[model samples]
Target chain A: MSEVREPQSDERLQMPSDPYSVPLDKIDVAQPHLFANGDHWKYFERLRSEAPVHYCEDGFEGPYWSVTKYDDICHVDSSHNLFSSEPAIVLADPEEDFELEMFIAMDQPKHDVQRKTASPVVAPQNLKVLESTIRERVCTILDSLPVGESFNWVDRVSIELTTQMLATLFDFPFEDRRKLTRWSDVATTDPEQDQSIVASEEERRAELIECLEYFGKLWHERAGNGGGSDLISMLANGESTKDMVNKPLEYLGNLVLLIVGGNDTTRNSITGGVLALNQNPAEYDKLRANPALIPNMVSEIIRWQTPLAYMRRTANEDTIVGGQTIKAGDKVAMWYISGNRDEDVIERANEFLIDRPKARQHLSFGFGIHRCMGNRLAEMQLRILWEEIVNRFDFVEVVNEPTRIFSSFVHGYAEMQVVLHPKKA
Target chain B: MAKITFIEHNGTKHEVDVDNGTSVMNAAIDNLVPGIDADCGGQCSCATCHVYIDSDWVAKAGSPDDQEESMLDLNPERQPNSRLSCQIPVTDELDGLVVTLPEFQF
Candidate 1:
């Protein structure tokens, strides 16, 4: 099957400047340019009102249904039997030549078996052991931040902390921890947009292949050593996934899934929280008044940021959602980012209030069986980071507009310049 | 204190004494009960801690509010006695509470 390609010409990302005044027929929320230019909020809001279960006949990634309403998204995401996660979980189809076989893209018994293998990593017992280690590393990263000087928070704080945590989770080589972040970006990035991420599709595959080779060595070593509690060891030792070594593509796919799953959600939320607090100073003040609210504030931040914009599913059979008929084989994209802001489900849906009731009732970690297994781990990381931040920095001042990732899938920052001002004792 | 009996989908029973004011979700998760994932850390989101209240305890378990009801609607297996364990607070008035874990909490 031929996949939809992003427009790469001179007018590649050109979008209507006025989102509010654009004709309803012209709206395509899947356009990466809308997100890249930070112009999607109004467009999605318009879709929520005019067409909640909208269909895009001209989506860049081919025609796919956009489930923008919260209830509709829940219906689509929860009814996995009717809407399959197979083939792929994004608008883009798997490459015909090199299909990645991660469990999140699989359905039923297979998804459950492979998912159970990695579930122990985020088990409550393991988190108890990892908390102090995470807090210590967080404090070290925060203390090293240069006060009274503007720097890229993405690099200085967000990436550094999350990368370190990923390293710990995988027991990866501490010195080359940044590679995890790199592979994550490459996995989701479009080569057409930036050469720095990946110059071409071949290079993307080569880099990922190289990623598999490295992890492959780790898998062998861990398996020989009788396995352990780390994610790689768990996969290698788990009955369902042990033979993944023979299936290199599946191994690579699961590796990519774990890397991206463990990396993006928390890292982006870390940066987004800083930008959010700066954008909504009252919320920051509320946070400052009672550091006890850090835990709840963390959930609100994740809900508000919605790091992963959406997860796609293919309709297995004809179904009605939001009073719209969706036929079998139709590509369905559950817009978690839009659902996070659904006004009816979440009161004051657009605001950044930390004290909002039912703050965690959002679609950021998704819903149903495909719900993020690392959700509590992600929340704990953010909660601890903010706890440390409130005690130390009075403000994480955003100096300029953030450069957001061009992809519609990873709703995150590429560069956000900020300065941390220390609190007066 | 309230004594809560959690029966896994396979019929494994874990009876624990939870302090009044603790949530049934936390009680299960804290005790390492097998069925309740509580992936959201007891948040009303991610309906992973869904349970079926015994008919005897249904009235005492109380009906779900608007938010909890909205979440429960997403669970296909949800029944009239269904309640999100996270939303149910343990209290002395309901000393012997029984919540049967669903086969699928996803």
Candidate 2:
């Protein structure tokens, strides 16, 4: 990827086609099983070119239509009535549902009201109130890192800040915050599907009962206190209409979503930005030389990494998209992975240009109604994060090819061997 | 300079003089008016700068558009007067506008 390909500028860069015509089974990178193999982008590129609106019928991880075009993604994402986040957001399959419910998964009036319940916490006024607290925590995490020593930046830097932020949001005891982070990551990334984190597949229902009982106590206690310092307190006080009666699982699920949803996704963006910078010395130096550019650089990194790869949506009605008709009840996964590199909207789309005027315009957070609710908070975390990292680290590099998590939905680095050379003490 | 009045949830009114072409949200924040966050840096994304408009100035501010209306679904108490301050441009017509901020936007 380092060697920039040169061609006549007149022609737009496009996905190559011979590969898209291949049978889904025969297609490279089609199986979720191959997610570990890496090089998934090769197949993504093929499909993006030949069948921008192609369906993956023999999908091992998905049989849904993969919508890769930027505009098409916007169309599907913006049309809340046409495509519902309900029926779930991940591309699991025909029959599994998680115990959690989220504003991101609800549509219209319900999604609207549900979003209000948590919006106060994310609203600028609220987040700004927490800025100093967040910065202190960010500094605490950074201050704890061994100076001039190699460490897993992902664990110490990315995860810690976000997890701690979630802890503050839940007002959970700090020592136990990591447990919440783990539960969140596991609940979301478990592609095995329909299995509660608490139980074996054999007694899944029984296990959920136990898990729910334990969590329900906390939910009620928080609600019992009638809301407190954290978001749980806010939701407990905010009115949910007649439709939301006694749904502890849904309420608890929302807590989980807020934690992981805001946690790893932005965490990955930070790690990805450092990895990209460390790999591209010129870009890093470009940033260090112009500290005024940190905010824009953060945007570029999010555009480039697009930490949360794709979110699934089910069609409420049949609609034609990208020259293909999607039947009602069919599943469609909008791969943010492909959309970010889209050639049409972005010139030299594959390349990361730090000064790109439109870096903030990327659909990485998504577009329209269901666009990420935590986007501002995520940016606040990332911007201040990069401000610190760019000032402290003189040099950083990836020592090994990072191993990715197994799930197709989460494109995250499990282990990134990194070496960070500290700034002169 | 233009006059901008901020009505607090408790019914306290703090008025400010603002330059033309500034966002009502920006003017509120610039004047240190109690409750505007402007978190997204005025990207029209974060709904933190929400305010309820005084009906007298509704014509000056006009109605919330689809984008603003949709975002309002995320505000704490939905009122017919709900509008994201960032979306309401501070034009000459809005010179005498009165806006109320929720007790707390968070």
Candidate 3:
């Protein structure tokens, strides 16, 4: 046993893979490279079918329980007592001691407060007002792309969407939106992999101070004048969103939550959706044919893309799931990437069928109370963008294979070059 | 046209006349009832369109399928009365029925 394990450890240490290296074969809930294999959908199809709640010792994310089945994931999400989102969701925070961090690392009573403060801003009703602007932003960004010319779709469009939308909501200056997006990408999505992030921690910290100062200004303005408006005002002023969470820790946590929430998740979804459509022209054509199906199509795209692939839940007291005993404080990762394609849950799960009758039933936004607050807004953005794409662009095609971001937490592309030409009416 | 009554959680009743094919969720959305949110636009994923059917009408409305039953587990205050409004397509049998909406669907 010693000899066998010794060689494996030696081999791993001897040859390090990519910076954000993830072995696609393992049942890691965090692997972003599952798309590398054509079997991305069914990489764990057999495991999900077999164990449902199997533990993976081979996971780069480490020995966390992989909850792959539909019901189990929902069970873990809802029962916050048993499966806590705090301590850490992705893995142990790479930056062990960073002063600029917040209470996103804390559990209940705390997570509840932060989530509450941030939820309303991204809520469905508020998002409805931003739909037209989101559409206009998508078009304005897309229109800038040259006809039949290749450009990085992820960099140009997806990243920009997240940057601009988040900035608009936060009322950040327009010019600084992209900077905020880049800083957010480095800060939340594993600062370890991006060396540029490591070298520029000081710069990132400085910008963060600037942002905090700006927000501080907003808080004072609201506190004194009381505009009776803006998310910043409500957050700086609103009373407890949850019963036990009226503290200032959550207020700071709310900042981290809002930044990550507003940025990466939607960024990946947009890039993934566009790539999926370009790859499957038939699915794109189906969407083009009805146009009315844009809503359902949006659902399908989210499922297929599975952005923010997996969320980590720390085990509370010792418990059993899928017949496996989980020790207290054990990290259990609910692999939404796998569950989205669970054959038991979705028929022909691997195939990207826009017209799939039950495609809206994906767990990408998650289940239970932790279900994404930004879901409606995400769909609204997707629907309008698709509608506009079909109506405006005569032809859009992937001109080069997309270069994926080297992050285990966010399953997304960093760059995907494409060509677009206006349709001749 | 079919007549429907919505008995809200606050003990308020809303009545709407609808065509034969619209769903209970659709009716609430169409009539702009204060509580009902068809967030998935009448899909079963969001239990936002949840309603509590009258005990006497559970049989008429039948139980939700396995998928919907699973979805409802994620919703709050799950009782025997809970059902996804999208699964219950509007029909003649559902006419003059009363359903109640949960307080927080977000």
Q: Write the per-residue lDDT of candidate 3 for residues A94-206, one digit (tens) a residue.
A: 34344332444445555445556656676665776778888889889877777777888777877887788877887766886776675566455433334334445556555
Write candidate 1's Cα lDDT for B47-102 as tens digits. 77899999999999999976577567645567999999999889998799998998
**Per-residue alpha-carbon lDDT of model 2 for A338-382, expressed as tens digits?**
888889867887887777764766778776567677777888898
Task: Identify the runs in model 1 with alpha carbons over 4 angstroms from their true place.
Answer: A1-14, A194-196, B1-47, B50-96, B99-106
Candidate whose TM-score is highest: 1
lDDT of 1 at A101: 93
Pairs that collide in candidate 3 are: A394-A423
Model 1 chain A poorest ten-residue lDDT run: A1-10
lDDT of each: 0.85, 0.71, 0.68
Q: Deviation in angstroms for A392 in model 2?
A: 2.2
Interface RMSD after interface superposition, model 2: 5.2
i-RMS values of the candidates, in order? 8.1, 5.2, 6.2
> Quality of candidate 2's docking, in CAPRI categories?
acceptable
Best by lDDT: 1
Fnat for every candidate: 0.08, 0.36, 0.06
- Candidates ranked by lDDT: 1, 2, 3
Question: What DockQ does every candidate get?
Answer: 0.12, 0.24, 0.14
Task: Tell me the spans in candidate 2 whose CA falls farther than 4 Å from its real position.
Answer: A1-30, A33-35, A93-99, A191-214, A224-226, A241-245, B1-68, B75-106
